[model samples]
Target: MSVWEKIKEKTEAGERLSSEEGVYLFREADLHQLGQLADGVRERKVGKRASYVLNRYLNYSNICVLSCQFCAFARRKREPGTFELSVSEVVDGAKQAVALGATEIHIVGGLHPSLPYEFYLEMLRGLAGLEPRPMLKVFTAIEIRHLAERVAKKPMVEVLGDLQEAGLDSLTGGGAEIFDAGVRERICRGKESAEEWLEVHRTWHGMGGRSTATMLYGHVETAEQRVDHLQKLRGLQDETGGFTGFIPFAFEPSQTRLAELGKIRRASALEELRVIAASRLILDNFDHVTAYWISTGLPLAQVALSYGADDLHGTIGEEKIFHMAGAKTPVGQTRGNLERAIREAGREPVQRNTFYEAIRS
Candidate 1:
């Protein structure tokens, strides 16, 4: 049978596609047809309302030790621009986000080698003590693990316990890049293993805390590897029912080690859209899929609404990661901007909190 026929049969039966099938659809199926199928799936699942969060992106520090090949955002402690924020400075950023009408504070940053776990706890305490307290979705699985194993030299339960006590609402960052070990060895060596990454989420879910998952695509990975990555996340979601959303972002290759070595290039628009569509089709257990407007431009992100993406992520007051990797999109967007984008896409704009709960529509 033809590739399209196989995809159609799976779609019609509402059956999960194998990795081979996913690869075929992503690589061979007509882009428009794949998008239509994905849109239909999206409608069946989430309906016409699209979601966005009004939040600020605050990275606490740029100083990091591991030199991931695809990263342009991390710097050694002595690098010219490398710095970490004090608790007071962090509170200042939180106050600024609140004054700008933010309801969530999205915090993620480098894994500082020597900063003690108390730093994280104190930062969370400072934010939670503010007058207009925002939801604290901070850190990634790897970050938590780092604090537990490297910095704290203890158990994650202990580290996570402190954060929970200090008012950590959820974990929100991308440490799960590509799960295939081979790809990880070359791109993000010394990072947590795939199992380690999943274990972090599993442990968090067991603790009653929720989190989001992300896949960094358009780098040195194949379609099969991408499908495998999604499959692993799908399995975790099925087992725990803890992931609130899935975000897929393209790799920005400018000024990174990957770019310097000619190992990777920017993903074409078709490739990026195809990944979004494939994710919606493959990760059946997920409730929302983010187009990640920070990586994909607003125009294409709007197009993604019809292609199975249901969330534009947030009006990130200032995003540093993508910009460092040569992203040209605005560091931040206003609520009006997100609402207008959703409305223009012919979908209702729903303002949501960190966990996909509608705050206002």
Candidate 2:
């Protein structure tokens, strides 16, 4: 049977595709064909409403111990301009985010080599104590793992439990650069290994904590590797069912060791669309697929809605990681801009909280 025939059969049966089938969908399917299949899956799950949020990203520090080659954001502990935000300073930033109508505070920072585990707990407490507190979605699995071993000196499960008690709402999928160890070794050595990243999320999911899964594509990863990454996430979701969304980000090559090794190039618009559409089709157990506007740009991100994306992550008042790594998009977007984009895509826009609960617009 032809590949299209197999994919259609799987779609008809409402069965999940294998990794090889997903790879074929990424590489061989035409635009409309892939979009139609993905949209069918999306409709079966999320319906017609496109979800969004108003949020702010706080990069609390640039001081990091692991210098990943693909990273353009982290700085050495003794680097001239390296900095860390005190607990009071992060709270002040959260105040700014809340005053600007943000309902969620997204926080991710470099792994501090010396900070104790109590520091993270203190940050979460500070955010939780604010009036009209926004949901605190903070920390990557790598940072969590680091804290577990280096600071808390406890197991991953216990450490995560402690943080949950301290008011961490969710985990962001940042440390998952790519799930292939060969690629990981070349791009982001000395950080959490692929297995470790998965294990951390597994631990979180087992504890009933929800988080998003991400794939960092378009750098040195193969189409097959991308499928493998998705498949691994799918397998985990099947077992634990704690993933809230899947976000596929193309690697930014500027101002990093990856660029120094060669000329930096961003993923083409076509590649972004293909990944979005394919993600919708493959991640059968996941409820939402997000087009992160900061990384994909407004134009391509708007187009992504038709391809299979049901969520436009947020109107981020400020974003640092993408900008520091050569993103040319605006840091802030208005509600008007978000509504227009969804309308232009022929979809209804609904504002939502971090948990996908609708907020009255």
Candidate 3:
């Protein structure tokens, strides 16, 4: 048989595809054929019940120490738009979200050069104390490393332990752009290395914690590099089994240096669906693959369900990062809106908590 036929046979048999096969599928597989294979896998794994979370996003601060070339959200400490919420302010915002029926409060921020380690613990403590506590999914692997190596000056294990004690339910899947060292250096020089990012998650999993994974694609990365990134994530998941889901973020080029340099543009909708479908196939070990509507508009995100996505991330309240990058989606979607979208896509909508557990169907 030909290479494509061989891949089709393996995929049909539910066997793991090699990195070469993943790259080939990503580059050469017919879009509809790939979608069929991926949708078949998704159906076997999670069925037609798609999910959404009633979650709120909180960016505690924007003053970052590193100037990643592709990031439009980070600002200098004295920059005009720089802001950091006090612990009380963050708790108050989360309290309002909880009152409005949010089941998860997703928080992430830059690697601030000055916030003391106590600030994070205090913020977590206050949010944890809220009545009907929500799952506090906070911090990326990069932020965790920053807290350990910079602010806390403690070991990563110790820092994660402290954060968990203070009530961190899970880790956010940001900060993992493209994991290829060459491409990563071109876009996000001085950011944590791919190994460092993986090590952070590995350590967290060793502590019996769970988190999600992400890949920021459509930037300065090749198809081979993208497959390599997925292979690495799959290897880690094989070892730890701690990843709850995978989110593939399309690089939003507007307002970013890459855009200014004329080196990048937004990924096309076809590319976005291809990435989602490829992720579903390659990351077979992962249970969920999220079509984050904040970056991909709701319309395309709705189309992504038939393309292989099983989860429409969540109802994020006022997201700044993607908005800063010129995302035009609404700041948030209501539960009714999410259900309507799912139902329109010919799938049953399931209300899910952070762990993909159905809160209601």
Candidate 4:
């Protein structure tokens, strides 16, 4: 059978594809054919509803210990422009986000090498104490690891348990650049290793915490490496069933060490669709796949719906990571705009909480 036929057969059988099949789907399948197959799988899982959210990104600090090659947001601690948000500052941002109709407050920031574990807990407490509390989705596994080792001086399990008690609703998959160690060494050396990253999330999941998984692609990584990354997440999801969604983020090479390589081009629209489709086919255990509108523009995000992406991420009222890395997409978009994007994609839009629970907007 042809590659397309094989993909369709496996998808119809509700079977996950092997890494070879994932690479084949990435290379051989036409965009439209891939979207059709992906849509079939999406229908089997989520039906015709396209999920989105009215959310906000609350970046607490820019000071970082790991000066990753591809990141433009993190700043060295001694840098003149480095800043950290006080507890009141974070609460102020959450208050504004809540008032603006944001149901979820997504928090991610640089790994503060000197901050105590209590400070991190206090950040969550401050947000949770808001008069009208928004769901606090905070921290990546890397940050958790940093806290455990440097701040808390305790085991990862203990650190995670403490954070959970503090008010962490879920984890946002940020620091996972790619699971391949070779690519990791070249791009982001000082950050947690691939196994450590997974182990942190795995420990969180074992504690009954839910989180998302992401793949940062379109960098020095190979197509096979991308497939390998997905396979790793897929295997983990099968084992723990902890991942709430899978996000495939294209590497933005603009203000980092990788950018010095050349004027890196964005991932082609076709490549974005293929990655989404293949992710859906490979990550059978993951229920939601997001097309992050902040990273990929609104038009491409809309197109991704047909290519196996069922979620449009969140509002991200003021996103800094992509903007710092030279993303031209607007910082904030209204619910009406998100709904129109879903409608244009020929799917119904549904607002969802951080855990993928339907939120009536």
In terms of TM-score, which candidate is strongest? Answer: 3
- lDDT at 93, model 1: 95
* Model 4 alpha-carbon drift over 4 Å, by segment: 259-263
Tell me the tens digit of each residue's lDDT in model 2 across 216-248: 887888889888888899989998998889999
TM-score of 1: 0.97
lDDT of 1 by residue, 275-313 (tens): 999899899889899989999988889999999899999
Among residues 3 or more apart in sequence or in different chains, the pairs in candidate 3 whose N, CA or C atoms overlap within 3 Å are: none
| Deviation from native of the Cα of residue 338 in model 3, angstroms | 0.6
Q: Each model's TM-score, in the order given? A: 0.97, 0.97, 0.98, 0.97
- What does candidate 3's lDDT look like per residue over 176-282, in tens digits? 89898888788999999999999999999999889999999987789999999999999999999999999998988878866543467689999999999999989
Judging by lDDT, tell me the better candidate of 1 and 2: 1
Pairs clashing in candidate 4? none
lDDT of 4 by residue, 1-361 (tens): 9777887888899877877888887777777887888888888899989998788898889999888888888998988768798888888989988988888889998988787777889989888887677888899889888888888899999988888888888998988888899999888888888899899888989999999999998888887888888888887888899999998888777666565534667788788888998888888888999998888898999989988899998878898888888888899888989999998888988999899989863
Clashing pairs in 1: none
In model 2, the runs with Cα more than 4 Å from the true position are 259-261
- Candidate achieving higher lDDT, 1 or 3: 3
Tell me the spans in candidate 3 whose CA falls farther than 4 Å from its real position. Answer: 259-261
